[model samples]
Target chain A: MKAWLRFSTSIVNKSVISDIMKLFDIDFNILKADITPRGGKMLVEIDGPQASESISYMEDKGIEVTPILKVVKKDTDKCLECGACVSLCPVEAISILDDWDIDIDNQKCIGCGFCISSCPTQAIALME
Target chain B: MKTIEEINQKIKNGDAVVVTAAEMTLIAKDKDIKTVAEEIDVVTTGTFGAMCSSGVFFNFGHSDPPIKMNKTYLNGVEAYSGLAAVDAYLGATQPNHDLDIGLDYGGAHVIEDLVRGKEINLMTEAYGTDCYPLKKIKAPITLENINQATMVNPRNCYQNYAAATNSTQETLYTYLGTLLPNYGNVTYSSAGELSPLLNDPYFQTIGIGTRIFLCGSAGYIIGEGTQHFTEAERHHGVPITPSGTLMLKGDLKKMDSDFVRGATMPSYGPTLFVGAGIPIPILNEDIALRTSISDEDIGCKIFDYGVPRRTRPVIKETNYQELKSGKIEINGREVPTSPLSSYKRAVKVAEELKKWIQKGEFLLSNPVDLLPNKGQLVKPLNIIKPPKMVCDIERKPVIITHPTDPVKEVAKKLVDNDINHLPVVDKNGKLKGIVTSWDIADAVARGKTKLEEVMTKKVIIAREDEPVDIIARRIDKNDISGLPIIDKDNKVKGMITAEDISRLIGKKNNK
Candidate 1:
């Protein structure tokens, strides 16, 4: 739970930190989110179900994931069968039309969302 | 059974608790609890925790940039506090701070003495204690970006003439010339420093080398070494037409080297323009607009409309009543009075008719081709074509004074008029020995008592037909004002001075 809290960089105020840390009675180290020019996204993973309630508690206190979620299409009927998106798709989720129909390899999709937004049509959806 | 008070007793004994404002309000029935909660609330918690899920959402609530953690100065002590304090002090003590700052920064010490005192000091103190409303967000500004604009001002050489002796107008021009090469925009006025009159805020930052061009009645101190150029547009309120006009070169090679494809001579008035056929001659419409009138209309308007404003009818003093009565004397015969109202009315009608005649004829005229030779619109006062061809004559008019005229009065007048020679003339207006500008100097040098006491009557004389160069050599050798251009009887045709040579040959190399 403390490790998950360390990944969420929302409380910049020292007073807020002391108050919230005292309320939960937990000692946690804080880190700044790695904000790239391309985007800034804070990721947290709970290893145990016991940490779920604490994660929910932190969420309730105004800690957020990536502020914006971009929805886009990767594979659709607009494909000219050039296979450019397929080759450029880092996760290999985009595939050429097998039988004149595009197939999205959903299991292979890393949910990085770049390919979805780069597609030329409203054919791919990034579920938030 | 344990009552609810027993559970509350347990909570008070240090059980885990989540106290909200509503529960705190119920506890706040006791003033002591209310005071305790108020003290504990160091910062206000946001009410829109769910709505403002992200910092971007907070930005959507207001267009201002997000208040990032790095923005805080020393644990939320905003940097604006110090800056605001300074701005407040400036505003209170100097309500006209924008204007005051310019004067102070310009080193205007007198203004400081006038504005600074005990009252301002007290106001500044009072202003400091007041709170200033914090702006939600202001765009970042850099000093370099702020100074990247041109400032314009009018300049009067007369007002600051004493101070300007050390100040160099040439330096101002040179600086502007340097900046022009770098494609920097600069501003100057034909009127005199305009920033104060225009209430320009950037006067202080405008720089010492800022070029100021005053073209008209800027009340110039005559000997202050101030000179202005003749602008292509006469709209600068001064009649300084270029002494020599721009001419197109006929030599094909020279033409190609001299001007670019789009190059054309700057035009003035209604004149015939000839150039390489590539870029044809343009009318006044081609120039910068303002008082731009058609080339055909310029001559008529200037000669007819503008001139008549000064010229008046020659109404003889004796005939004033007769002219007012609309009567006329024609060939020694008196005519019956017409029904005109007054002399003013007759003059007005005459002026109108003269304008009609001028407009009708003058508008159709064009300048004669002065090709191969650059033209000048010379005034008669500034030109003299001797009746006979004379070569190498001195350039200036020689002054001849009367030998009997009081030398003191003549010398004083000569000095006042800025002329050197005073040609001595008899009562009959015949020539005599010339008093050179240096003659007065010599009289002063020798400390002569009077004009008759010490006067130089000896002088070299030349005929009107003498080659100017020969006369020039004699004048130069003798170190005199010049030989008078006399007739066969030794009467003054005209007097030759060094200025005559300068007027002719000195300007030959110009343009």
Candidate 2:
């Protein structure tokens, strides 16, 4: 299970991850972290039996945890297949196929939200 | 050479071998051009790109008492109502008065909404006249009410376009779309090989009255489009820059929202993304050869859009094959590339057009007149001012020198007058040659004392009536500091040096 965890500016300076490591029986891996003194979000993979318990614990500790079923979703009906998002993917997750249809590899998508903004039709949306 | 009528006859009989521009490229590579020419009858091409110079003219008929509407607004977007009482032209790029710059609703949106069968508010204001008594009117209108909703796009279907990238530190929002800073990404708008104009590069078959698939409906090439510059640099019969465009006209009421889209280019206001295609009749081997040129052969110049100027400098030239590969090397950095034009829609347009022709539902029309290949030039809009002639600029009197004068005397005159050029005249006072300081030094160094030996006989002279700009160009072209201004009789009129022009400019600046 993957989830996006956000910390409030007040709790940003605290070592909440360390607390979770000692408190929860769950195993986790931080997929990506973009944090600042002002506080930001971190995408993490939490696939232990106590993943839900861990998420609830983070919420209780003044952290917002959103379960990530998918990093980005595309409404195929609205996609114009203009290739506006093909190269914006730093990890080469999105591409235009031979038939000119957009193919998104969520495995490679780091949830940068570049494709979401680059799309002219606003078809691609960040999924939480 | 196969005649257009012959191709039409085949099309009518459902026996014409037709293919899309994309298909033609495959066949072209496998078979010889001559074989391809003999095998193919017509090649259909398409492009779904943002064409800014698009609009529609509507005649809303006479209002209640038929008010002479001098101003008209459709859903808050201003439409040009400078024509007759009820006729107005709504441009695609016109921004909505009420909306912000980003994704702002405009006339293009109105057009799309109308095509989608959505009702739009129509408002107008005018001074009451005897013929038209009503002063103001506001009404919700749909595609049903308008008597004439003709889309007369002055320009569409660009032959080729520049790929833009930003080399500056900050991002740039351009008509090409948003270019990330430091050559972050490249955006190109042309469909390359699938583009109609690239298929018929010379506009031999595509001309006035040529039938086309414009925005999902039948359209015609009314005339050569605005900024139809055919003189752009070519690579394999296709332009490497913004060249050859089409002035298309079609029924806006019949167009589909899928093909006729209202697009907002990031922060750069509104523009219509039109889908258009032209079926080229392979009347000759040359046409077949041209239509088959692949994307690898068609090149697009990448320009740095960081500089806010009309003429952006080209950073590098790369073909569509490289551009489509998603990465290109520029300044030793591998920058990613993207396309603003929908190639999928372009293919769909070509496929749709091919289906129409194959089913005998659509027939190709012979152009009444061909597009102009000459005399059409894009005259830049610049500050209007009169030309200043060489005579207008203050210059020194002609320092006369006879051909019989000694080299030492010529050098003395040059040194005393603080002048570099002294025109050497013959016995008849007609200008023969000119001696410069460099020439004097060369004469002394070469131990040649004759005035004829020192003086350059092949003198490049400037005419008094010549425009200052022309003289300046001549000076730069010749790589000289000065020139002797001469009259019709070849007599030295005056001497205009680069220094004199600079001095005059300096004094003018002081004032």
Candidate 3:
């Protein structure tokens, strides 16, 4: 069943990420955060069976993950063309600003906190 | 009148000139030097070995001559001879700066009180001055200065006094060395790399009878750096004997001399001197002996052979990723599967993943639920399908004659390998009788003439349409191992057994 746990890059940092994964024993992939829009939270997606299991695991650690919210994709209209996020991308997930304000490379991004730390204008964040 | 060699020879012979306190008192009174040596042995046997194991010692005193005095003494003459012997032993045992030494407190007191206090008489020189302030000392008071008003001879006079200042004090001694009143702090933790012997894990297992010499770094690690007539002074300096500068005899002499090579000589100050006969080899082997230098043969041989460095054990970690993957071949094509996959085929991949996670083949952040993803459950073999009927083998009949019987007879009369029972019938075939292996057994047990009488009877059976649970219940209630499979026409078709039921539930007799 291709089941994987997901995490938001906002709260957890890369330093403690490996330790947390080892501690929980969960298999997951990281998805980059899209923070340009105002309301954005951590996004974790899984199939029905694994989704329930992941939620319970998070709950056990007192991390409430109920009433799940939909992942909010970034809008193309808010193009500032600042090109500030390109350098901040740890996994090189953010593309060069040309015709578009910002383009995301989903494959390279590990959904970590690099872009969050680099965002001077606080424009980028993970959407859930 | 005796030379240093002659004195050393006397001490080696175990004879020391002892000058007692009373004799010293008389010498102070008479002011004589000639009769003192004659009255006491040149080297006293009583001071053969040093008193304490280790600590700093000081000597600042002088002694009276023996010409005017006729009696012996223990005051200063005995200790000086002891000091000389100690230095000899230290020079012999640890020629290198390898040995930790004990200090002579008596020597320090004598030097400070007798030599500096009486001979030099600093108090007398500064008596008329009011500029010098009164100083209070917090150490043990062993000796007090008194009665120095007599007109003194050259030997007893303060002019011949030499002061070993704080800097000079550390270097003049070796084994029984001591630091000045305040010479930095003391370290109580492991020193250096903490020699291998003390750090060896198997050290405790060594038996008491083993003559382990605590030598080299091992000696210093275990030894508290205490030796009689020796002190461990933290300061650095050159080694100077009473007669000559041991460290400054030129390159050829220095290269050949082991004693002066490693000796720490203070350039600006005196280093600590330890003068004990305990060698490094002795210290390495006999931990008990090294600690107790007070033992009779503290300087004697502690080990007949030298000890070699011990090797440390190595540890390695193991990997079992291959066995855990459980890769199997399907039509010569390799596919990885978990051992638990065979138990539940629908979630084979999920089971494999779970097994890998458990074996640490892959890291897992949390527990996961198995996903179906259109996975199909493996079906059981058709031969062992659920029972469609319940029949008692003992109740069914075996018909020997008649083919034109009813359809029930026709159905039960078949000579099939799967069917072991049959219903007997007359011309009408109106449920006349049944036959089975048990019927024949009963015929034999009852000593019946033939199977005909025993086989004539009623059949205990259920319809084929009955649920498997109901059929199992009937078999359990009847206490029979097998039953007949009957259709709605009241005719037998097949048979069932406990073995078949057991085979369906994943049970195997071989396993």
Instruction: Give stretches of model 2 more than 4 Å off.
Output: A6-15, A22-53, A59-64, B99-103, B384-511
TM-score for each candidate, following the candidate numbering: 0.19, 0.76, 0.15
| Most accurate candidate by TM-score | 2
Say which candidate scores most in lDDT: 2
Per-residue lDDT of model 1, residues B1-511, tens digit only:
2222332343344331222222223343444533433322110000100000000000111112222221211111122123222221011011122343321221111112112210111111112112432323333222122211111112121110000000111111110011111111111111111111111111111122211111110111111111222222222221211111121112111111111111000110000101111100012221111111111211100011111112322212122123222233433543222110111211222232223222331011112321111122333343375422353443445455666666578788788768766666676666766776677777778886456555566656666655566566567757776556767666666666677766656665583
Candidate order by lDDT, highest to lowest? 2, 1, 3
TM-score of chain A of each: 0.42, 0.68, 0.41
RMSD of 3: 40.0
Chain B TM-score, one value per candidate, order as shown: 0.23, 0.75, 0.18
TM-score for predicted model 3 compared with the true structure:
0.15
Question: What lDDT does the true structure give each of the candidates?
Answer: 0.29, 0.86, 0.28
Tens digit of per-residue lDDT, candidate 3, span A17-76: 344455554555445333333323344433443445555665554343533332223333
With candidate 2 superimposed using the best TM-score fit, by how many Å does residue B251's alpha carbon deviate from the native? 0.3
Q: Write the per-residue lDDT of candidate 3 for residues B1-511, one digit (tens) a residue.
A: 4433443344445453323221233442453334443443311000011111221222323222111111111122112123311110111111111123221212222222232223322210111113323221111222243221111001100000011111111212212221121111010100001111111112221221211111000011121111111111111110011110001001111011101111111111111111111111111222221111111111110110011112111111111122122232223443221110011111122223223323333221111221111222323356565443333222333333332333333334444423545555455533445666555456557676443465646455545454555556556756766555656554555555565555544433455
lDDT of 2 by residue, A1-128 (tens): 77899988999998888888888888898878889999998998887777788788889889999887788899987777888778678888888887888899877777878777666666889876
Off by over 4 Å in 1: A1-128, B1-399
Segments in model 3 whose C-alpha atoms lie over 4 Å from true places:
A1-128, B1-422, B425-431, B445-447, B506-511
If ranked by DockQ, best first, what sequence of candidates would result? 2, 3, 1
lDDT of 2 by residue, B321-369 (tens): 9998888998899988889899999999999999999988889899999
